[model samples]
Target: MTPPILTVRDLVVTFGTREGVLTAVNGVSFDLYLGEVLGLVGESGSGKSVTGLAILGLIDPPGQIARGSITLDGAELIGKPEEELRALRGKRLAMIFQDPMTTLNPVLRIDTQMIEAIQAHERVSGKAARERARQALARVGIPSPEERLDAYPHQFSGGMRQRVAIAIALLHRPAVLVADEPTTALDVTIQAQILAEVQSLAAETGTAMLWITHDLSVIAGFADRIAVMYAGRIVETGSVVDVLETPIHPYTAGLIGSVPSRNKRGVPLAQIPGMTPSLAKLPPGCPFSPRCPRATVTCRTTMPAETPFAGARMARCHHPLTGEPLAA
Candidate 1:
């Protein structure tokens, strides 16, 4: 079997706050294969975005990747020097933020930024790199790419700018791409287009992508697999069909229930009972126990280890759900 393009094991990210050390991502693990999109789904503060930053070595001061392994193409990245990680970031790995402005410079023209991005990793001529930049823009469905490249980031609308960001992230055809809710802020129509573009591009370029989002519906048609995260940990993971159709974790079921469905018309939209638990003070047992409907005494006192079910399916729940998924 071909090895995964990216592997993350027991990833723990922490920050030192006035209240003390807070673990944003606790013992999260997953794998990303070439051309596969893994949807990391969870609500705000679930640490999905933090996981992406940790993988990219972008966690700033007070924030650190505490004890774990992040490997890209079999090379360990967890303890590598900043210089080494920087060298690999754009060439072997890349990231796209939720906001295009986070990846773009307001003052720079799109062409200049794209050309510079290409040049930063490869020793290509200016004209050659510029042409590549134009091609990338076109690949993302940006019409008049040649002319659009000459404009500044401000000149482009939100959706168009996000396409530019996606174009830049794919410029190197990196082995892995971590997208942290890149489409969350766009309208439904634009979000669908962006999702389609990204899905097709990943297939075309053979780039393994970690797409982070809280929307189950958004991930349903976009990802090959889903990793349901809660309270800084992955509660369940499996193929999109299996996980969505038969989620074993209560948290996963709750998230699915929250999504609007045609079958649920006129029924009150289901909702998870409690708010996300605080990372600074997670429960001693399952981090999600407080919010989990199926949690028991064991679930409230002892953390459940990853329990494997049939064929690559796993969930961190003592009382895993069986049969059909929640009827949302």
Candidate 2:
């Protein structure tokens, strides 16, 4: 088998505060292959975004990557200098933030911003860079790309701005793209279009994508594989179909069940009881025990290690559900 484009092993990220050290990500591990999309799904504060930030070496002071390895195309990134990481970023690794404004400059015209992005890592003439930027915008379904290039970010609609952000990220055709819920706020139609465009771009460029979102519906048809995270750890992972159809972990099942389509029409939606555990004061064993229905005395006393199952699946649960019904 071909080696994966990115490998993250036993990754841990922590934040130091006056109160205590809070583990934002703990022992998270996964691989992203060329042209593949891995959905990182979790509720808020489950460490999904932190894992992506750590992969890009974007975690600031007070927050640190406590341990583990992040390898992009076999190059270790854990201890690399800021200079080296900056050089690699946007050239070999790019991230699309949840907010388009985070990636765009309100004061700058789209053309100027995109041209600068292209020229930053490559020594290209201004005109050549402009052409590249125009093509990227066109590729992402921006109509009359040339005209749009002259407009500032504020001039475009939310969906259009997001498309521009995606266009900029793809300008370098970075080997990996970490998209942190870029479409969460958009309407379904716009979100679907962006997802299709991104999928096509990834296939064309052989780019591995880590799509971080709390919405399982967003990932159901988009991701090749799914990794369900909870309380700073991945509770279940497998091929999208396998994990969605037979989620062994209670948390994963809860997330899937809570989606509206899974319930009878006009019925109350299924919800996972209890809130996410506080990272600074997590329970001694499984952080999810308090919320997990299947959690037993053993689960509360000793955390279960990731156990392999059929069909390349893994779930961290001592009493994992089997053959559970996922949809109404």
Candidate 3:
């Protein structure tokens, strides 16, 4: 098997709150291989976004990576100085945030920002950088790339701004890309277009990508593997087919069942019973026990270890719903 491009082991992120130190990411682990897309799925407040931020060394004050390790191409990222991590960020690792404005400079013309991004890591001339940036815009299907380059972030529509942000992220062909729901705000047509472009770029550049979203349907056709998270931990992981078809963890099953395509016509949507537990005050045993229907005495008191299955799948549950026919 090929070596993984990125490996995260036992990652733990924490936030200092008035109540206490909240464990936002608890012992999360996964590997991303070159040219592969791994979908990280979970509900809001599940620490999905925090995991991505931890990998990129972007966690700010009051939030820190409390434990574990993030390795990129065999290099340790934990405890690396800000300057060092910043150097690696846009050149070797890049992130596409959910909001384009978070990435684009509202005060600067698009060309100025893209040129600076390229010049930050390379010794390319302004003319060369501008050419590359123009091509990137064209690659993402922007019309009149040359003309658009002269415009500011505020000039473009929301969808267009997102495409520009995506174009900037691809400028370096970084080894790994963490895209945090970058297309969620766009219309379905634009979303589909961006997904295809991103998929193709990863394949062409051999970029390892971690695409984080709450929608399983969006990932069903995009990612090579799926990792389902709940309460800051990865509860189930496997190939898209394996996990989607035979989801072992109760939470994974619940999420899959909730998709509109799996429900009967005119039937109410299936949903998990309760809200996600507070990370600051998670239960002693399984954090998900309160919402899990399969929870037993043991599940409510002792957290289960990850159980490995065939096809490189694994789930953390005392009473996994394996071998059961999933709702169609």
Candidate 4:
């Protein structure tokens, strides 16, 4: 079998604070294959963003990838030299940050920025880089790409700016595209458009994509597979059909139940009972034990080893949910 385009093994990420070390990602592991989209879904503070950054080698000073291996195309990235990682970043892997305005330069015209990105990876001349930039913007469905290229970021609407950011990310045709809440700030219509465009682009380019979002609906619409995260760990993973159809983990079930449409008419929205555990003060066993209805003494006293539910479906729960699954 061909190896996956990207593989993460026992990945652990931690942050250094005045209080102490806080674990953000605890032994998270998954794989992304060529031409597939993987959704990392969870609520806020679930360490979804931290996992994306760790894979991209973008964790800043206070946060670090303390353990585990991030291998892309069979090369370890965790401890590579800065220069080597830098070379890999824009050329082989790219990220679409949550805030597009922050990602694009407010002072520089789109053409200048995009050209610089292309030129940075390849020894292309000024005119050639400009053409490449224009093509990328056009590819992302930006209207009047040439005209938009000369405009500064502030001159564009928020949605347009995000398109530009995504365009930059795709400029190098990176093998892996990590999108961290790429649609969070956009209106539903624009969000839908961007999601469709990204999905199509990934298919055409055979790009392995890690789409990090809190919206399970979005994952249902776009991802081939879904990995449900809770308290810095992946609690369940499977094909979109299996995970959404038969969510074995209680937390996964809760998240699905909380979706507005899942609740009955005239009823309060179904909700998971407790807040996410603090990274600095996580409970003794399963980080999600406090909120999980199925949690038991085994869940509170010792972490449940991952158990298989079905093909490629794994859930970490001693007493998992069982029955008809909720609809997305």
TM-score of each: 0.96, 0.96, 0.96, 0.96
Q: Write the per-residue lDDT of candidate 1 for residues 1-328, one digit (tens) a residue.
A: 7999899999999899998999989899999988899999999999999999998999998999888998888999988988998989888889999987566899999999999989988899999999999999999999999999899998888999999999999999888999999988899899999998888898888998999998889889889999999888899999999999988998888888988989999999998897897777788999888888788899999998887777578888888887432322
lDDT of model 1, residue 16:
96
Cα displacement (angstroms), candidate 1, residue 58, comes to: 0.9
Best-to-worst ranking by lDDT? 2, 3, 1, 4
Question: Please, what is the whole-model Cα lDDT of each candidate in the order they appear?
Answer: 0.89, 0.91, 0.90, 0.88
How far in Å is the alpha carbon of 73 misplaced in model 1? 1.0
Q: Which portions of model 3 miss their true places by more than 4 Å? A: 323-328
Q: Tens digit of lDDT per residue, candidate 4, span 128-198? A: 99998888989888889999888999988888989998888888788999999999988889999999998
Clashing pairs in 4: none
Clashing pairs in 3: none
lDDT of 3: 0.90
RMSDs, each prediction?
A: 3.1, 3.3, 3.0, 3.1
